[model samples]
Target chain A: MIRKWSIALLGWGAILGLLAPMLHTIWVSFSPDSFLTPPTNVWSVKWYLAYFGDRRWIHATSQSLLIAGMAALLAVAASAPAAWSLGKLTVARQRLLSILLLLPALIPPAALGFGLLPLVYFTGLWGTSLGLVLVHATVGLPIAFLIIRTCLPAKLGELEAAAAGLGANRWEVLRRVTLPLLTPVLLAAGIAVFVLSLNESLVSIFLATPTNETLPAVIWPQLRYSPSPMVAVASCVTALLGMIGMLIVIGILGYQRGRLIAKNTTAINS
Target chain B: MQRISSWLPVFASVALVCGVVMAPLLLLLRVSLYEPATGRGFYTPGTFTFANYAIFADSHVLGIAGFTVLCGVAVATMVLAIAYPLGLFLCSLPPRAQSIAVGLILVPKTAGLLAMLFGLQRWLPRGMLATIIAEVYLVLPYSVIVIYIQLLNLDPTLRDAARGLGASPWQVFRRVTLPLSLPGIRLAFQFGLMWGLGAFLGPLFLGGPSETTLAVELHRQAFEYGRWPLAATEAVGLLIVVSIAAWGVPTVAQLRKVAHS
Candidate 1:
C-alpha cells in the first residue's frame, strides 16, 4: 500500500514537473503586464497580438514551417526505401545497417551542426532554407527509418514472393500492394519527422541567417537578452504546432488500431 | 532482373548514407587535424598536426570535459531514479489514463527546447540544480516510455506466481520485475546519458559560469572564436564519449545473452 501511494505521488510529481514550464509559458503569454510585475489575474492576448504584428516573427514562423515541411518530406523520401530494404535483410545485417543509419542522430547535435558548416559554406547554402532542409532531413532520417522499419511486417517477404508468383511485376507489387499497406506508417513517420524538425533549435541556431531565422532561433536571443512575455507567446505558438503534429500522429494510430480490430472481427466471422 | 532491382535500393541507400552522413563526419575529422593558419584562415590546407587536440590538455578545457561527463552521469542516474517509479505507476493506470500521461510527457519533448528552457528559467533557481532538473525533465518522458513498454510486455504469470508463493510486493519487484526490466532501464539510461552529454540549452540558461560544459565551449570556439580546428577536436572528443555510451549498452546486452546461452 505504501509503495503504491509513493508511486502515485511520484507519477503526479513527474507530470507536474513536466507541465510547470508549459503552464508558466501559458500564464506569461496571457499576462503581458507580468513582465514587470508578478503574475496576477489580469490576462490579455496582447503578446499574441505583438507576436503577429512583428514582421520578423511572422517571417520566422513561416520559415520554420517551410523548413520543417520540406525536411519531413525529404526524410521520408530518404528513409522509406532504406527501411524497406533493411527490413528484408537478415537480423544481423539489419542490426548493423540500422546502427549505421542511426549513427548521425547519435552524434551530438553540436558536432553535427559544426561539421556541416564547412559543407554549407562551400555549397553557398549558408543561411538558406535549402541548407537547413538538408541538415534537418538528415537528422530526422533515423526516426523515420526506425518507424518504417518496425512497421514493415515481417511476413512482407512472403507476401511479396506470393505476389511475384502470381505474375505481378516488381513495380506492380510495390504500387498495388506494398505502398497501400505502408500509407499509415508513412503518415506516422512524416508527422514524427515534422515535429522533430519543427522543434529543432540547436542546428537551426548554428545554420540560421537573418533571412532564414526559425521561430526558435528568433526566440532564443530574446530569452537571453530581453526576457519578455513575447518570448512566452512565441513559445506557446511553437508548442501549439507540436501538439497539432502529435494529434495527427494519435489520429493515425487510432485509425490503424480500428482497422486492425475490424479486420480481426471479419476474420472471425468469415 | 528482379534481383538487380532489389539490390538497386540497397546500393542507392548505402551511397546516400555515405555521401550525406559519413562524408561530413570525415570532413570534421580531417579539419580537426589541420593546423590553424595565421590571421582569419581557420586552418592551413596542406599542414596537419595534433595541436588542436593538444589545446584540450589545458586545465580549463579538461575541466569543462570533466564537468560535462559528471553532469551526464548525474543526470542519467537521477532520471532513472525518478522515471522508474513513474513508469511503474503509469503501467498500473488504465489505457486512457496512460495515454493522457504519455501526451503530457510528449509536450516537452516535441516542444522547442529553448521554449521549455525559457519556461524553466522563470521558475527554477539558476545553477547546477536547475540544469540537472531541466535535463532530467527533458529525458524523463523517454525513460518512462521505455520502461512502461517493457512493463507492459512483461509476462504477468511471473508476478502472479511470485505473489502466490507469498512473496511480498517488494520481493516481487526486486527479484522478478526489476531483473526483467533491466534491458529497458539500461536503454533509458543510455538515452538520458546521451541527452545530458549533448545538452546545450539547459547548461546555457540554467547553469552559472562554472557550469559551462564542453558543448558550450565547442560552440564558442566554432562560432565566437572561428577556431574550427579546436572546435572540431572538441566535437570529436564528445562524439567518442557519446558513441561509447550509446553502443556500450547493446554490446553488454549481447554479451549477457551469450553468457546465458
Candidate 2:
C-alpha cells in the first residue's frame, strides 16, 4: 500500500509539475498587470489580439512556418536514404558511420550554432532565410533518422533476400517491397522534424537578424524588456502547434501499429 | 553476406549531406586562428594567432564551462536518483496504467521547451534553483522513458525466483534488479548529462547571472558581442569537453555491459 501510494504521488507530482508551466503561461496571458503584480479580471484574450494583430508577430510566425517546413522536407529527404541504408544494408563500419551521422544531435546547439555563425557569415548566407533552413536541417537530421529507423520492419532483410532469391532486381525490391514499409516512418519523421524545427530558437538566434527573426527570437525580446502578456499568448500558441504536430505523428504511429498487428496475424495463419 | 555496392549511392549522398552540414562548424576552427582585425573578413588569409583562444581562456568562458559541467553532473545524478525508484514503480503497475503514466510524463516534453520555462517560471523561486528544477523536470521524463524500457527488457524471472526463494523485496532489488540494470542506468545517466549540457533556452531564460552556463555564454558571445572568434573557440572547447564525456560514457557503459553479461 505504501509503495502504491508513493508511485501514485510520483505520477501526480510529474503531471502537476508539467501543468504548472502551462497553467502559469495561460494565467499570465490574461493578466491585467505585468511582472510581479497581482492579476485581476476574469480570463481575457487581449494579449492574443496584441500578438496576432502585430505585424512583427505575423511576419515572425510566417517565417517560422516557412523555415520549419523547408527544413523538415530537406532533413527527411537527406535522412531517408541513410535510414534505409541502415535498416536494409549490412556492411562493415555501419555502426561507426551511424554514430558519426548522429553527432549533431548529441552536441549542444549553442555550440554548433556559435561555430556556424562565423562560417555562415563569411559565406554571404548569414541572416538569410535559406541559411537558417540549412542549419535547421542539420539540427533535425539525427532526430529524423532515429524516428524513421525505429519503425522500419524487422523482417526487412528477409524480404530483401526473398525478393533477390526470386527474379526481382534491386530497384524492383526497393520500389515494391521496401518503400511501402518505410512510408509511415518517413511521415512520422517529417512531423517530428517539423515540430522541433518550428520551436527551435538557439540556432535560429545565430542565423537570424532583426529582419529575419523567428517567433522565438522575437518573443525573446519581450521576455528581457517589459514582458507584455502577448509573450504568454505566443508561448501558448507555440505549445499548441507542437502538440498538434505530435498528435498527428502519434495518430500515424497508431495506424502503423494496427497494420503491424494485421501483418503478424496473417503470418501466423500462413 | 555478399558485399553490396548497390547502397553506395545512398551512403555517398548521406556523407555529402553530413559534409555540407558540417562545413560551417568546421570553419569555426579556421576562424579561431584568424586575427581579430579580420573580423568579417574571416576567410582572408591572415596571420594565425592564439589570441582568440587566449581571450576565451581569460574571460568567464572557463568559469561558464566549469559551471556547465558541474550542473550537468548535478542534474544527471538527480535524474538517476529519481528514475530508479520510479522505474521500479512503473514495472509494478498494470500495462494500461504504465502507458498512461508514461504518456503523462512525455506530454510536457512534446509541448516544446518554451512551455516548460513559461510554466515553471511562474510558480518557482527564480535563479539557479528554478533552473535546476526545470532542467531536472525536463530530463526526468526522458530518463524514465529509458529506464522503463530497460526494466521491461529485463528478465523478470530472476526477481520472481528470488522472491520465490523467500528473499525480501529489498534483497531482490539490491542483489538482482539493481546489479542487473547497470547498463541501462549508465545509458540514462549519459542522456541526462548530455541533455543538461545542451539545454539552451532553459538556461538562457531561467538561469541567474551567477549561473551563466556555457550554452548561454555562447549565445551572448555571438549575438550580443559579435565576438565570433571568442564564441567559436568557446564552442569548440565545449564540443571537446562534451565529446570527451560522450566518448568516455559509452566506454564505461560497454564495460558495465560486458561485466553484467
Candidate 3:
C-alpha cells in the first residue's frame, strides 16, 4: 500500500513537472503584470489582447496554421498509400522501407535545415510556405505512417481477397471496403501530423523568412532578445491548440479501439 | 495488367521519398565538401577541400562536441531514471488513469519547444542544469510512452507464473519485467540521447554562454560568422555521432536478443 502510494505520488509529480511550463505561461498571460514581479491586481486578458493587437503575431499564427494544415494533409496523402503498400509487402521488405521512410526523422533537424537551404534556394522555394510544407510533411511522414499502419487491420489482404472472390473489382474493393476502413486512422494521422508540424521549430527557424515567420519562429526571437507577457500569450495560444489537437486524437483513438474490441468480442461469440 | 496498376501508388511514394528526402541529404553531403569563401555567400562553388574538416582540430570545436556528448549522456541517463518509474506507475494504473496521465505528459511534447523553453527560462536559472531540466521535460513523455507500451504488451502470465513459483514482487520485476522492458528502455535512451545531442533550443534559451552546445555552435558558425563549410562540417559530424548512437543501441539490442535465443 505504501509502495503504491509512493508510485502514485511519483506519477503526479511527473505530471506536475510536465504541466509547470504550460500552466505558468497561462498564468502569466493573465497576470496583467511582469513575469519578474508578482501581480498586484486581479487577472486580466490584457496580454491576450496585446497578442491579437499585434499584426505580426496574427500573421505568424495564421502562417503556422496554414503551413501545418498543408503539411498534415500532404503527410496523410503520402503515407496512406505507402502504408497500404507496406502492409502488403513481405516483412523484410516492409522493415527496410519503413526505415527508409523514417530516415528524415532520425537525422538531426539542423542537418536537414542546413542541407535543404541550397536546395530550397535553387528550386526558388526559399522562404515560401510551399517549401516549408514539403519539408514539414517529410518530417511528419514517419509518425503518420506509423499511426496509419498500426490502425490498418492485419487481415486487410484477406479482406481484399474475399472481396475479389465476391466478384468485386479492385477499384470497387478499395473504394467500397478499404477506404472506408481507413478514414478514422487517416484522421488520427492527420491530426498527429498537424501537431508535430505546428510545434516544429528547429527546421522552421531555418526556413522561415521575415515575410513568412511561423509562430514558433516569431516567439524564438522574442524569447531570446525581449521577454514579455506577450510571449506568454503566444505560448498559451500554441499550447491550447496543441492540447486540443491531442485531445481530438485521443478521442478518435479511443473510438477506434472500442470498435476493435467490439469486433473481437463478436468474433469470439460467433 | 491489373497487378501492375496496384503497384503504382507504392512506386509513386517511393519516388517522392527519394526525390524530396534523399536528394536533399545528398546535397548536404556535397555542400559539406565544398570550399567556403569568406565575404562570399554561404558557400563557394567549384572547389573542394579537406580543410573544412580539419577545423575540428580546434580545441573550441572539440570542447563543444565533448560537452554536447556529455550533456546528451547525462540527459539520457536522467530521463531514463525518471521515466522508468513513471512508466511502471502509468502501466499500473487503470486504463482511464493511464490515458489521463499520458495526455498530461504529452502536453509538453506537443507544445512548441520554444514556448516551453520560454516558460522554463523564466522559471529556472540559466546554465547546464536548466538545459538538462528542460530537455528532460521535453523527452520524458517519449520515454514514458515507449516504456509504458512495452509494459502493457508484456505477458501477464509470466509475472503471475513467477509469483506462483514463490518469487517475490521485487524479484519478479527484476527478473522478468526489467529484462523484458530492456528493449524499450534502450530505445528511450537512444531517443533521449539523440534529442540531447541535437539540442539547439534548450541550450540556446536556458544555457549560459559557457554552455554553448555543438548545435548552437554550428548555427553560429553558419549564420552568425558566415562559415558555411565549417558549419556543414559540424552538422555532418553531428549526424555521424547521432547515427552511431541511434543505430548502435538497436544493433546491440538485436545482438542480445539473438544471443538469448
Candidate 4:
C-alpha cells in the first residue's frame, strides 16, 4: 500500500511536471510584460496579439508549414517504397540494406546537420524551400522507414502470395490489399514527419536564409538575445501542436491495433 | 509493360533522393579540413589538414567533453533510479492505474524540449544544477517507457512460482523481476546517455558558461566564431564520445546476458 501510494504520487507528479511548463507558457503568453516575469496584475492577451499581429511571425509560420508539409509528403513517399521492399521483398542484401537505411538515424543528428550545412551552402540551396524540404526529409526518412517497418505485417508475404494465387496481379495486390493495410502506418508516419519537421530548429537555424526562416528559427535568436514573453508564446504554440500531432499518431496506432485484434478474434471464431 | 514503366519513375526518384542524402555526409568529412581562406565554400575540394583535429587537444575543450560525459552518466543513473521504482509500481498496479501512469510519463515527451527549456530558463535555479535537473527531467520519461515495456513483457509465471515456493514478494522481485529488467535498464541508460550527451537546447537555456557542453561548444564554434574547421573538430569529437557510449551500452548488456545465461 505504501509503494502503491508513492507510485500514484509519482504518476501525479509527472502529470503536474508535464503541465507546469505549458501552464507557465500560457501565463507568459498573456502577460502584459515584455519579459517572462510572473504576472503581477490582470493577465492580458497583449503578447498573443503582438505575436499574431507581427508580420515576421506570420511569414515564419507559413514558411514553416510549407516546408514541413512538403517534407512530410516527400519523406513518406521516398520511405514507403524502401520500407515496402525491405518488409516484403526477399533480397540478397536485405540486412545490409536495412542497416544502411537506418544509418542516418543512428548517426548523431548534430553531425548530420553539420555535414548537410556545407552541401546546402555550396549547392546554392541554403535559403530555398526545396533545400529545406530535402534536408527535413533526409532527417525524417529513417523515422518514417522505421515506423513503416514496425507497423507493416510480417504476414504480408503470405497475404501477397494468397492474393497472387487468386489471380491478382502485383499492382492489383498492392492497390487492393497492401495500401489499405498500410493506411494507419502512413498516417502515423505522416504525423511524425510533420511534427519533426515543424520542431526542427537545429537544421533550419543552420540553413536559414532571411527569406526562409522557420518558426523555431525566428524564436531561437529571440530565445538567446531577447527572451521576451513572445518567445514563451511561440514555444507554447509549438509544444501544443507537437502534443496534438503525437496524440493523432498514437490514436491511429491504437485504433489499428484494436482492429487487428478484432480481426484475429473473428478469425479464431470462424 | 505500362505498370513496370510507371513503377520505374517512382524507383528512380527514390534513388535520386538516396544520392542527395549521401552527398552531404561525404562533403562534411571532406570539408572539415578546408581552411576557408579560399573563396570557395564547403563543397570545394581542398587538401586535408590535421589542424582541425589539433585544436581539439585544447584542455578547455577536453574539459567540456569530460563534463558532458559526467552529466550524461549522472542523468543516466538518476533516470534508472527513478524509472525502476516507477516501473515496479506500474507492473504492480491495476490496468487503469498502469494506463494513467504511462500516459502521465509520456505527456512530457510529446511536449518536446523547447517548452521545458523555456520554463526552466525562467523558473529553475540557474547553473549546473538546473542543467542536471532538466536533463534528468528530459530523460526520465524515456527511461520509464523503456523499462515499463520490459516489465510489462516480463513472464508472470516465474513470479507466481517463486511465491508458491514460499519466497516473499520482495525476494521474488529481487531474484526474478530485477534480473529480467536488466536489459531494459541498459537500454534506458543508453538512450538517456545519448540524449544527455547531445543536450544542446536544454543546456543552451539553463546552463551557465561553467556548464558549457560539447554540443554547446560546437554550436559556439560554428555560429559564434565562424570557424568551420574548429566546429567540425568539436562535432567530430562529440560524435566520438557519443559513439563510444552508444557502442559500450549494448556490449555491456550482451555480456551481462551471456553471464546470466
Best-matching candidate per DockQ: 3
Which candidate, 1 or 4, has the higher TM-score? Answer: 1
Q: Considering DockQ, where higher is better, how would the candidates rank from best to worst?
A: 3, 1, 2, 4
lDDT of 2 by residue, B112-191 (tens): 56655666666665588777777888788878878988899889899999999999989999999887888789989988
Per-residue error (Å), model 4, residue A138: 2.8
Task: Write the residue-wise lDDT of candidate 1 on B134-166 in tens digits.
Answer: 878777777788788888899999999999999
lDDT of the candidates, in the order given: 0.80, 0.74, 0.82, 0.74
Candidate number with the higher TM-score (3 or 4): 3
RMSD in Å for candidate 2, one decimal? 3.6
lDDT-better candidate, 1 vs 4? 1
Report how far residue A26 has shifted in candidate 3, in Å: 1.1
Candidate 2 chain A: worst 10 consecutive residues by lDDT? A32-41
Error of 4 at A257 (Å): 1.0
List the candidate numbers ranked by TM-score, top first.
3, 1, 2, 4
Which 10 consecutive residues of model 1 chain B have the lowest summed lDDT?
Answer: B8-17
Task: Judge candidate 2 at residue B44 and give its lDDT.
Answer: 38
Native contacts recovered, each model: 0.50, 0.50, 0.55, 0.32
| Reference-based lDDT, residue B188, model 2 | 90
The regions of model 2 sitting more than 4 angstroms off are A32-41, A87-92, A163-169, A261-270, B1-13, B38-45, B56-59, B250-261
Q: Which candidate is the best by lDDT?
A: 3
Arrange candidates, best lDDT first: 3, 1, 4, 2
State the DockQ of every prediction.
0.55, 0.50, 0.61, 0.39
lDDT of 2 at B110: 58
